[model samples]
Target: MVSSERLADIGYKTFSGTMTLYGGYLCSLRVYRYFHHREQLRIAAENQTEDIIKD
Candidate 1:
């Protein structure tokens, strides 16, 4: 008799690995954008506050 393999086992080796790699890449990009946006806002707010203080 021949043995049959399940799809889940095959998927664990292939699809799951790819998904994890892509997810990590996407997460890093999101974090980078979040920090970049926050920094930009901070700089803008500081500049505005400085101008107001000067006046």
Candidate 2:
């Protein structure tokens, strides 16, 4: 049989589940933007390095 603490824990889990999902989604978006920005910087650096080498 489920005890009172178990029931309360389940309730907390349910509430936190929604928060966790939303937090995860926002975190993923931030990570995606960070990676995209880093990729652009990497490409720009490579181009600059090549230009310097050619000069």
Candidate 3:
């Protein structure tokens, strides 16, 4: 798992306004962010499902 500081470092390094939008580092960051978002959504859905089951 990537630490928050490491993600910050990646964001800082990639979006320093000196690099192109198509850089590999930026792409990886986007993908990582996407998956992280998805994971959060999945966890929330599971919690909601559990609550419904309990009720």
Candidate 3: where is the Cα deviation over 4 Å? 1-22
The whole-model lDDT of each prediction reads: 0.91, 0.99, 0.90
Show the lowest summed lDDT stretch of 10 residues, model 3: 16-25
Q: In terms of lDDT, which candidate is stronger, 1 or 3?
A: 1
TM-score of 2: 0.59
State the lDDT at 13 in candidate 1.
81
**Superposed model 2: Cα runs more than 4 Å off:** 1-16
- Report RMSD (Å) for each prediction in the order shown: 3.2, 4.4, 14.8
Candidate 2, residue 12: Cα displacement in angstroms equals 8.6
| Candidate 3 vs. true structure, TM-score | 0.58
Compared with the true structure, what per-residue lDDT tens digits does model 2 show for residues 1-55? 9999999999999999999999999999999999999999999999999999999
**Ranking of models by lDDT:** 2, 1, 3
Best by TM-score: 1
Location of the lowest summed lDDT over 10 successive residues in candidate 2: 10-19
Candidates 2 and 3, the one with greater lDDT: 2
Ten residues in sequence with the least summed lDDT for candidate 1: 1-10
What ordering of candidates by TM-score runs from best to worst?
A: 1, 2, 3
Question: TM-score for each prediction?
Answer: 0.72, 0.59, 0.58
Q: Score residue 33 of candidate 2 by CA lDDT.
A: 100
